[model samples]
Target: MSLLSMTKTNLKALFHGPYTSQFPLKAREPFANTRGHIDCDLSTCIFCTLCDKKCPTGAISVTRSVKATDTTPEKKGTWSIEPLKCIQCGYCVETCNKNSLIMKGECSEPATENVR
Candidate 1:
Protein backbone atom coordinates (compact mmCIF):
# COMPACT_ATOMS: atom_id res chain seq x y z
CA MET A 1 0.00 0.00 0.00
CA SER A 2 1.05 3.61 -0.54
CA LEU A 3 2.10 5.82 2.39
CA LEU A 4 -1.11 7.91 2.05
CA SER A 5 -3.35 4.80 2.31
CA MET A 6 -1.36 3.50 5.30
CA THR A 7 -1.76 6.80 7.09
CA LYS A 8 -5.52 6.84 6.44
CA THR A 9 -5.91 3.28 7.78
CA ASN A 10 -3.95 4.12 10.91
CA LEU A 11 -6.06 7.19 11.56
CA LYS A 12 -9.27 5.19 11.15
CA ALA A 13 -8.09 2.55 13.60
CA LEU A 14 -7.09 5.17 16.17
CA PHE A 15 -10.53 6.82 16.07
CA HIS A 16 -12.47 3.50 16.34
CA GLY A 17 -10.88 2.62 19.69
CA PRO A 18 -10.79 -1.07 20.74
CA TYR A 19 -13.01 -3.55 18.93
CA THR A 20 -13.41 -5.85 21.92
CA SER A 21 -16.24 -5.66 24.46
CA GLN A 22 -15.77 -4.89 28.15
CA PHE A 23 -14.77 -8.38 29.31
CA PRO A 24 -16.40 -8.65 32.77
CA LEU A 25 -19.64 -6.90 31.81
CA LYS A 26 -20.08 -8.46 28.37
CA ALA A 27 -18.58 -11.92 28.15
CA ARG A 28 -18.32 -13.42 24.70
CA GLU A 29 -19.98 -16.77 24.04
CA PRO A 30 -17.60 -19.67 23.65
CA PHE A 31 -17.26 -21.06 20.16
CA ALA A 32 -18.87 -24.35 19.24
CA ASN A 33 -16.86 -27.42 20.34
CA THR A 34 -14.66 -25.16 22.46
CA ARG A 35 -13.16 -26.95 25.45
CA GLY A 36 -12.66 -24.81 28.52
CA HIS A 37 -12.61 -26.55 31.92
CA ILE A 38 -12.66 -30.17 33.09
CA ASP A 39 -15.14 -31.28 35.73
CA CYS A 40 -15.27 -34.76 37.26
CA ASP A 41 -18.27 -36.46 38.86
CA LEU A 42 -16.80 -38.48 41.71
CA SER A 43 -19.98 -40.48 42.34
CA THR A 44 -19.75 -42.34 39.03
CA CYS A 45 -15.96 -42.40 39.06
CA ILE A 46 -14.37 -45.77 39.84
CA PHE A 47 -11.03 -44.23 40.74
CA CYS A 48 -9.57 -45.92 37.69
CA THR A 49 -6.94 -43.17 37.42
CA LEU A 50 -7.37 -42.99 33.65
CA CYS A 51 -7.82 -39.23 33.73
CA ASP A 52 -4.65 -38.83 35.77
CA LYS A 53 -2.69 -41.06 33.44
CA LYS A 54 -3.99 -39.48 30.23
CA CYS A 55 -3.45 -35.88 31.35
CA PRO A 56 -0.35 -34.57 29.53
CA THR A 57 0.45 -31.83 32.07
CA GLY A 58 0.14 -34.00 35.22
CA ALA A 59 -2.56 -31.61 36.37
CA ILE A 60 -4.86 -34.35 37.62
CA SER A 61 -4.22 -36.37 40.78
CA VAL A 62 -6.29 -39.45 41.69
CA THR A 63 -5.59 -41.16 44.99
CA ARG A 64 -7.28 -44.18 46.61
CA SER A 65 -7.01 -45.15 50.27
CA VAL A 66 -7.03 -48.75 51.46
CA LYS A 67 -7.65 -50.05 54.99
CA ALA A 68 -5.11 -52.40 56.58
CA THR A 69 -7.61 -55.26 56.79
CA ASP A 70 -9.23 -54.70 53.42
CA THR A 71 -8.07 -57.01 50.65
CA THR A 72 -9.19 -54.66 47.89
CA PRO A 73 -8.59 -50.95 47.86
CA GLU A 74 -11.67 -48.74 48.10
CA LYS A 75 -12.59 -46.71 45.03
CA LYS A 76 -12.45 -43.48 46.99
CA GLY A 77 -10.01 -40.82 48.09
CA THR A 78 -8.64 -37.59 46.78
CA TRP A 79 -9.19 -36.30 43.25
CA SER A 80 -7.70 -32.88 42.76
CA ILE A 81 -6.85 -30.92 39.60
CA GLU A 82 -4.64 -27.86 39.28
CA PRO A 83 -6.51 -25.38 37.13
CA LEU A 84 -3.41 -23.39 36.31
CA LYS A 85 -1.47 -26.37 35.01
CA CYS A 86 -4.33 -27.96 33.05
CA ILE A 87 -4.29 -27.40 29.29
CA GLN A 88 -8.07 -27.84 28.81
CA CYS A 89 -7.43 -30.45 26.15
CA GLY A 90 -10.40 -32.70 27.08
CA TYR A 91 -8.21 -35.78 26.98
CA CYS A 92 -9.27 -36.77 30.47
CA VAL A 93 -12.93 -36.53 29.51
CA GLU A 94 -12.36 -38.78 26.52
CA THR A 95 -10.31 -41.31 28.51
CA CYS A 96 -12.85 -41.67 31.31
CA ASN A 97 -14.70 -45.01 30.98
CA LYS A 98 -17.59 -44.12 33.24
CA ASN A 99 -18.32 -40.82 31.47
CA SER A 100 -17.83 -39.04 34.78
CA LEU A 101 -15.66 -36.30 33.33
CA ILE A 102 -17.11 -33.38 31.40
CA MET A 103 -15.63 -30.44 29.49
CA LYS A 104 -17.45 -27.34 30.61
CA GLY A 105 -17.71 -24.15 28.55
CA GLU A 106 -16.62 -21.84 31.38
CA CYS A 107 -12.87 -21.47 31.65
CA SER A 108 -10.84 -21.77 34.81
CA GLU A 109 -10.36 -18.70 36.96
CA PRO A 110 -7.14 -16.73 36.58
CA ALA A 111 -4.52 -17.64 39.17
CA THR A 112 -3.97 -15.10 41.90
CA GLU A 113 -0.61 -14.22 43.45
CA ASN A 114 -1.50 -16.19 46.60
CA VAL A 115 -2.08 -19.42 44.65
CA ARG A 116 0.36 -22.19 45.42
Candidate 2:
Protein backbone atom coordinates (compact mmCIF):
# COMPACT_ATOMS: atom_id res chain seq x y z
CA MET A 1 0.00 0.00 0.00
CA SER A 2 2.80 2.46 0.84
CA LEU A 3 4.67 1.59 -2.37
CA LEU A 4 1.53 2.18 -4.43
CA SER A 5 0.99 5.59 -2.81
CA MET A 6 4.63 6.59 -3.44
CA THR A 7 4.35 5.58 -7.10
CA LYS A 8 1.16 7.59 -7.51
CA THR A 9 2.78 10.67 -6.00
CA ASN A 10 5.86 10.33 -8.17
CA LEU A 11 3.77 9.97 -11.35
CA LYS A 12 1.65 13.03 -10.42
CA ALA A 13 4.76 15.09 -9.84
CA LEU A 14 6.30 13.99 -13.15
CA PHE A 15 3.24 15.11 -15.14
CA HIS A 16 2.78 18.38 -13.17
CA GLY A 17 5.77 20.14 -14.75
CA PRO A 18 7.71 22.68 -12.71
CA TYR A 19 5.99 24.20 -9.69
CA THR A 20 8.09 27.35 -9.77
CA SER A 21 8.61 29.85 -12.54
CA GLN A 22 11.93 30.27 -14.38
CA PHE A 23 13.37 33.20 -12.47
CA PRO A 24 15.90 34.58 -14.96
CA LEU A 25 13.83 33.96 -18.06
CA LYS A 26 10.59 35.22 -16.58
CA ALA A 27 10.77 37.37 -13.49
CA ARG A 28 7.89 37.21 -11.04
CA GLU A 29 5.77 40.28 -10.44
CA PRO A 30 6.27 42.09 -7.19
CA PHE A 31 3.39 42.24 -4.72
CA ALA A 32 1.37 45.43 -4.23
CA ASN A 33 2.88 46.32 -0.84
CA THR A 34 6.32 44.84 -1.36
CA ARG A 35 9.06 46.89 0.28
CA GLY A 36 11.66 46.46 -2.43
CA HIS A 37 14.02 49.41 -2.37
CA ILE A 38 14.26 53.18 -2.03
CA ASP A 39 14.90 55.44 -5.00
CA CYS A 40 15.82 59.11 -4.91
CA ASP A 41 15.11 61.85 -7.45
CA LEU A 42 17.93 64.33 -7.21
CA SER A 43 16.23 66.98 -9.34
CA THR A 44 13.55 67.86 -6.80
CA CYS A 45 15.62 67.12 -3.72
CA ILE A 46 16.32 70.01 -1.33
CA PHE A 47 19.28 68.52 0.55
CA CYS A 48 17.13 67.85 3.60
CA THR A 49 18.52 65.23 5.97
CA LEU A 50 15.13 63.83 6.93
CA CYS A 51 15.60 60.60 5.02
CA ASP A 52 19.03 60.02 6.53
CA LYS A 53 17.70 60.60 10.02
CA LYS A 54 14.62 58.50 9.44
CA CYS A 55 16.55 55.48 8.18
CA PRO A 56 16.49 52.89 10.97
CA THR A 57 19.58 51.12 9.66
CA GLY A 58 21.55 54.31 8.96
CA ALA A 59 21.86 53.23 5.31
CA ILE A 60 21.05 56.62 3.87
CA SER A 61 23.53 59.48 3.61
CA VAL A 62 22.84 63.03 2.49
CA THR A 63 25.63 65.49 1.87
CA ARG A 64 25.19 69.18 1.21
CA SER A 65 27.70 71.03 -0.95
CA VAL A 66 27.83 74.78 -0.62
CA LYS A 67 29.81 76.95 -2.98
CA ALA A 68 30.41 80.50 -1.74
CA THR A 69 30.62 83.30 -4.22
CA ASP A 70 31.00 87.05 -3.99
CA THR A 71 27.27 87.69 -4.24
CA THR A 72 25.64 84.55 -2.84
CA PRO A 73 26.12 80.88 -2.06
CA GLU A 74 24.98 77.94 -4.14
CA LYS A 75 23.76 74.85 -2.35
CA LYS A 76 23.87 71.38 -3.81
CA GLY A 77 23.32 68.02 -2.26
CA THR A 78 24.06 64.36 -2.93
CA TRP A 79 22.03 61.42 -1.67
CA SER A 80 23.47 57.94 -1.48
CA ILE A 81 22.28 54.64 -0.08
CA GLU A 82 24.06 51.51 1.07
CA PRO A 83 21.94 48.76 -0.45
CA LEU A 84 23.35 46.02 1.77
CA LYS A 85 22.61 47.89 4.98
CA CYS A 86 19.18 49.17 3.93
CA ILE A 87 16.24 47.41 5.54
CA GLN A 88 13.75 48.75 2.96
CA CYS A 89 11.32 49.85 5.65
CA GLY A 90 10.04 52.78 3.51
CA TYR A 91 10.61 55.18 6.37
CA CYS A 92 12.92 57.32 4.25
CA VAL A 93 10.33 57.57 1.50
CA GLU A 94 7.64 58.72 3.93
CA THR A 95 9.87 61.19 5.74
CA CYS A 96 10.87 62.98 2.54
CA ASN A 97 9.02 66.29 2.47
CA LYS A 98 10.20 67.16 -1.06
CA ASN A 99 8.73 63.97 -2.52
CA SER A 100 12.13 63.16 -3.91
CA LEU A 101 12.17 59.69 -2.47
CA ILE A 102 10.27 56.87 -4.14
CA MET A 103 9.72 53.23 -3.20
CA LYS A 104 10.39 51.13 -6.25
CA GLY A 105 8.48 47.92 -6.69
CA GLU A 106 11.40 46.10 -8.31
CA CYS A 107 14.01 44.66 -5.99
CA SER A 108 17.51 46.06 -5.96
CA GLU A 109 19.98 44.37 -8.30
CA PRO A 110 22.74 42.11 -6.99
CA ALA A 111 25.74 44.16 -6.05
CA THR A 112 29.38 43.42 -5.44
CA GLU A 113 29.87 46.53 -3.33
CA ASN A 114 27.96 47.87 -0.34
CA VAL A 115 27.61 51.46 -1.59
CA ARG A 116 25.37 52.43 -4.48
Candidate with the greatest TM-score versus the true structure: 2
Residue 85, model 1: Cα distance from true site in angstroms: 1.9
- Supply the global lDDT for candidate 2: 0.84
Per-candidate TM-score against the hidden true structure: 0.72, 0.76
> In candidate 1, which residue pairs clash?
none
Best by lDDT: 2
**What do the candidate models score in CA lDDT, each in turn?**
0.83, 0.84
- In Å, residue 71's CA in model 1 sits off its true spot by 15
lDDT by residue (tens digit), candidate 1, 1-116: 56576888789989999888989999899986878888988777777788899999999999866644533424356688998899998889989999999898888777685767
lDDT of 2 by residue, 5-112 (tens): 688878999999998999899999999888888899887887778888888999999987665332222347678999989989898888899899999888999877
- Superposition error at 100 for model 2 (Å): 1.0
Give, for candidate 1, the lowest lDDT window spanning 10 residues: 67-76
